[model samples]
Target chain A: MLELLVSGFAAIFTDPLAISMVFLGVMVGIIFGALPGLTTVAGLSMFLPVTYVMVSHVGLSMLTAIYIGGTSGGLISAILLNMPGTPASIATTFDGAPMAKKGEAGKALGIAVFASLVGTLVGVGVMIFASPVLARLTLKFGPWEYFTVTFFALTLIASLTGKSVIKGLLSALFGMMFATIGLSPVDGTPRYTFGSLQLTSGFHLLVVLVGLYAIREVLLTASSKQEPIKVLKYKMKGLGFGLHDMAGNWINLIRSSLVGLGIGILPGIGGSTSNIIAYSVAKNSSKHPEKYGTGIPDGIIASEASNNGSIGGAMIPLLTLGIPGDGATAILLGGFMLHGMQPGPLLFQQNGDVVYSIFAAMVLGIIFMAVLMWSGMRMFVQVLKVPNHILIPLIVVLCSIGAYALGNRVFDMWGLLLFGFVGLMMAKFKIPAPPFILGFILEYQLELNLRRGLEYSNGNFWDVFTRPISGTFLALTILSMVVTIINNHKASVRELKEKKEGTA
Target chain B: MNSDTKREVQIGIFFLVLATAYIIGTFGISTFTPFGNRGLDSRSIPQLIGLLVIILSIAHIAQVLLREKQVKALLENEQEADTLVCDEDEVACIQPVKGTIIERLDRVFSIKLLLSFVYLTLYIAAYQPVGFIISSTGFLIAESLLLVKKEERKRWRTFIILFSIGASVLIYFIFTRYLTLFLPSGILG
Candidate 1:
């Protein structure tokens, strides 16, 4: 292990192209992430197709760099424009926007950059050391264990249910139904084809993503009479923070980063939730909690660090267990398959150098993100000055092109339009789209594991509960759902009390 | 036509109809299956989903009804408060009456919906015969022209068209050459 680490460091230093690709990837990722409506997933997806032409190690390096950089770059717009460049940065706006208003935009950005670097390093350290052990443990998991893990992931929809649990579950069920449109996974029997040749191929994932997030946002923004709100014009002054400030918040930064890494290692829990969790933890622990949302550097640091840290944390499962942590990692998994490399317990044994190269690239990417964000803050801020009418139309065109480009099929363009309309209707009805996305991604695994587990158990239902790992995971799933319900109920009661008090 | 009430009614009706249609569709599709399987078959999942949708729709209708009752109760309490005091007509009359159902329906079918219908129709019509590049460019140009603020519309028209055309062409080349993806040429092929 020591030798592998040493050789990995040496390989990265020796390969000039690897270093350059990492730098380039970070730059592209920052640009994409700093632009609202262009998420880390889109950036990774757009760049993923390019990996087909490159060597596996170099390609993986580039993808990792983009993932790391994109997660960190979101803070730029959140601080400068009060618009979250990515959903993960939503909590950053609470303090980042205020800090910008108070003319401490530079300090806020500096803190975000430094914290991101620290978080990413911590996450990478954990991943590099812990992935092998996790992979070995995962090797013991049987079909029942796989099914239970997937079931646990699907139950995360409860956490995302904003106000209506039934509506959220319905949305997830709808997604699962959509997944059943194509041929049956186990039997190859055609289902829900509706007599169209295109239906046989199933709905494209890219179309669903673009429609559910990008196109829907575009149409909603276009329909509304309200113009985009510009918060403050940001000015860059210092790129450095004092040691006193860093030392003062060191514990908070470490704690938040650990929280981020833990959450990211869990399938289906993405950087967005990590950001919110980190922000809440920081606020709860702060002596001056009231100053958090009023614009404090600590809030900015906590959110940015946690989200960036998620990049490395998410990679752990993807590289070692063949299970993606979130949508972006799922796409990365696709890229790995495209390169004829299967990512599972066997991956390290088959391609140790490739794994080491990815680690090296991630470290380099973190440094690149800090440097590029500090220097390129002005460029990202300028992007916010563009008028919405012009900006939205451009996004629409890009989305159309991206959808069409996926399969080079005109049918996919139609698919994009169809999903866009569905997305618009969903927005009108206030149904969240993430659960749908999660369901779609998990459908194949869920079905496959269930069938395999049943077959393995000879149709005995007790097998699912009898297995220790499956039972434990099932218990945890139930616990999580109960906790979510209690939390929501408490929040609603408090809200109702406050409302009544105000009325009286 | 109170907008909120109309919206709720329309949604309720749509879900009810959808549930019915899905059930019928699943049953019809299942009947056509050649093989007789007692176990989980192609039709099972869809049928299950359809049933779940029906149950959920019924629950939604009930919730909507309960919400309407609560809202009416609140409104009645407010009205009673108003009746207890002799209010000045000038200040009291400033509050607008809730819109009628017909007015809400009209709003639902306003110019925006008409424009969206037109846009989609134009897209489908132009997609095949005009090819991907030409149709997409045209769509972008027209959409931009329609969306531009009135004062800046004329000045930006030329720039918008040129930019749209450039973008379309660039995307065409990248997708075709680099990615090995094809776009529809329609009659232009």
Candidate 2:
């Protein structure tokens, strides 16, 4: 193991091509993440094909680097423009934007970068040691277990759906319905193609994701006025603060990292939920909870740390079980498959060197993410100064290029537009998009596993309960829904009481 | 109804209609083998999803209606209070671009949005025929110019045109030449 680790480090650093690609990937990822509507998923999807010609290690390293940088890059816009560059950075805006407004943008950025690096290191450490064991353990999992785990993962819709669980479920079901459009997993029968050849292929994840995030954003930007951001005059003073600040938040950092890693290991949830969950946990557990969401570093640390930590955590399942942790990892899965590298327990046994090389690249990527983000802090802050009129058009052109380049089919462009409209309507209707995305990604797996489970059980649906793991997950799903309902009820009741008190 | 409630109602109705279409679509799907195939058929999940959608949509519509009624009751009780009082607090809290609720709603339906969507539609339509370069260049220029503030449009005119053309050429070269990804060349090929 020691030799493998040493060789892995040497492989990335000794090879000039690997080092350069890693750096380039990080830079591209940061830029994409810094730009609102261009997410880590989009970056991965766009670059997946580009990596086809390159060797497996170098290409996979590049993709992994992008994931790390993109996950961290959201803090730039979150702090400066009060707009999260990626879903992972959503919670960053809670305190980050306020801190920026308070003229502590430099400090916010510094803390975010530092925490993200720390989170990445911790997550990578766990992935290196824990993945092999987890993979070995999960090797025992049957179709029933897979079905149950997926069911539990889908229950993460509870965490994502803001204010309305019903709307969230609706969105998720809608996504699953869309996924069911193509050929069936079991019988190879056409489901909902409606006689259209394009429909037979189904909607590409890229088309839906780009359309929802990028195209919808373009439309939104066009409809809104470009509010000029008042850039604060602040000195770049050596990562903005002393170690004393971080010393007090060791527990917060560790806790958030664990939260991120745990959530990331979950099949469907990733940084999108991890950041929010970490922020919530941090706030809930804070000595001075009131100080949260009011321009505090703890909130920023929690948000950045958890989201970045999830980068490594997300890789665990992908590397081990051939199950992608989230949308970005789903693309990464495609990248691996494109390179003819199937990730599973056998992967470690067969291609241990490649796995180690990826680990080495990830460690290097984290370092680059921290260093480059720190060095480019000044320029990234200036990114907010670019008016929307200029940025929006460039983004659209890129999005169009990305959609068209996927298959060189004009139909995808139309799909992009159609889903863009769907995204817009979703926003207008206050239905969350993340659940929908997760549902779509998980649909095929869910259906396949369910059918397989049934086949194994000889058509007995109750056989799921006979298997402990599947039964546990199904129980958790029910519990999650119930808890969500109760929590929402309590929240609404509290709000009503507050309103009544105010009226009185 | 309040605008928010109206929006929710529209969404509910949309889902309800979608549910109907899904059910119909599921029925149209070719089931093929009559028996002995598998545990669950292909159409089963879609049908289940369609039914779930119908139930969920109805429940959502009810929830929205109930909220609307409660809000109306609250509004009746607070009839003396100005309607904008709540809005003012939210607006102040958000400090959104263009401030005021009415202004934001106006912006939502702005001519720029209509023009942008229409232009995008035209661009997509023209993409294969007119080529990526021509259509993209044309789009970047028109969209950029359309979005720029009216007073600044003239000042930024030459820069916009140059930037649009440069961006188009650069993107074209990067994708086609470097990445080796085949983009629509049309006549330009």
Candidate 3:
């Protein structure tokens, strides 16, 4: 691993282009992340087609760099504007807003940045060790196991994303249905092509991503017509607080990082939930629990740390099993597949160098993220002032360029517009998009394995229940759905009771 | 139904139509069973998916209808049905088109949204035929102007124009030159 790391660093630094790409990616990522409404997923997806012409390792490394930078950059707005620049920073506002209100904005920003650095380091560190081990374990997984695991992941995402599991199910089904449009798995037969050759190739992930995120975001902004938020004044002198401020918070930081990592490893939830979960955990354990929301560094640390830690946690499953935990990792997964690399157990043997280089890039990227963010804090603040009107249209054009470049044809660009509309409708209806995206991503794998498993069992589906691993996973899928439904029922019943009592 | 429930029902019905179309479309998917067809063929999964979607959509619509009924019952007990005023801003509250073209267009998407979509369509249509430089320049300027507030248009116009053309040319060169990615020059070439 150490030797691979050295070689990976050597590969990047020796090639000036690759180094610059990483730097550029990090900068763009930070800009995207620090902007309200633009997200890490949006940054990665918008930038995806640009990397298509580059070397495999270089492109992947650049994408990872973006991932790292975007995750860390959310704290800038969370601290300054009291609005989370990305969903990952939602929990940061609890303490971050208060901290800034109390004239401790600099301290809050510094602590958040430092905490992000630590969280990323810890997350990436674990990913380096855990990925290969998990990859090896996955070598034992057969068709049944793979099928059941995919099913479980789908359900987990369905249950966890947004509200309404039923809507989640519909969304996933919709995505899967869309995925089935291009071609049938296994037999290589075309399904639902409707005679257009482009339809046979179906929609590229690039088209879906750009259309859904970039185009949808533009239309939503245009439609809602929100005036851009003004950047607030904040005083900053140094790293805000010294080592003494961090002295008493070592355990909280580690615990929050772990919480982030664990949630990140789970399908469906990522930085969005992780930061909040970590914050709550930190608060519950703190001696002065009431001090959590009252401008404490501890709350900021927990929120920032866990979300960053989730970057690593999210990567583990993605690199190892090819299952993305959330939207950001899903885009990363698309990047991998775009490079013609299927990230699975055999990836270690076939593309170990590229994988290690990504790991190296991430480690380096985190350092760059922390350094550039603090040093260029004033610039990011200016970035926040870039109005949504100009920013939205500009990003749309950029994204359109990306979509057009997908096949060097106009068809994919049209696909981008189509999905953009779908994305808009999905948002309007409050349907969870993450599940649909994950479902779209996993559809091929799911269908392939299911068919293969059926073949292996000679069309007897009951055999899946006999294998311990597959059976356990299937059981867990059922259990998770049942539990979610029951819990939702209980909550609604309690709410109804409260409403009835109030009326009386 | 209230707007929210109406929205849910619309989505549910849309999915139902989608599922029906998909299931119908599956018949056109010719079967190819390689290696003696011991298990399910290519058509099986699509069919399964179609069936599953049908079930899910039914359940969704049913759930929405049930909830709407519950809400209606509660609302009726709370107050008379005559007091239920539909907000004009609510999408479901839009009556069937009955007036001028602008008023008719209001039944669908907003005029701004319609114009933006038209711009997007024109931009995409022009992307290949008219080339990257002309197409992108036009797209960026029109889109930016449309999206920016009307009051600020005069101030932003020059900067928008310069940036649009410059960005288009720069991007064309950068992609074609440094990145080695193709960008059509068309008449500009």
Q: All candidates' TM-scores? A: 0.84, 0.88, 0.95
Q: Evaluate all candidate structures by whole-model CA lDDT and list the values in order.
A: 0.72, 0.81, 0.84
Off by over 4 Å in 3: B72-76, B80-111
Sort by lDDT, top down from the best: 3, 2, 1
lDDT of 1 by residue, B60-91 (tens): 66766775665555454443222121111111
Q: How far is A354's C-alpha from truth in model 1 (Å)?
A: 5.4
Residues A463-493, model 2: lDDT tens digits: 8987887788788888888988889879877
Over A374-489, each residue of candidate 1 has an lDDT whose tens digit, in order, gives 88777666765666556556566566655655665667667766777777676666666666766676676677677667666665768888789999999988898788778866
Native-referenced Cα lDDT, model 1: 0.72
RMSD of each: 5.8, 4.3, 2.7
**CAPRI band of model 1?**
incorrect
Off by over 4 Å in 2: A1-11, A35-49, A77-108, A237-240, A265-299, A317-327, A330-356, B34-38, B67-76, B80-108
Which scores higher on TM-score, 1 or 2?
A: 2
For model 2 the TM-score comes to 0.88
What TM-score does prediction 1 earn?
0.84
Q: Highest TM-score, which number?
A: 3
- DockQ for every model comes to 0.22, 0.45, 0.53
**Native-contact recovery for every candidate?**
0.23, 0.62, 0.68
Question: Lowest summed lDDT over 10 consecutive residues: which window, candidate 1 chain A?
Answer: A220-229
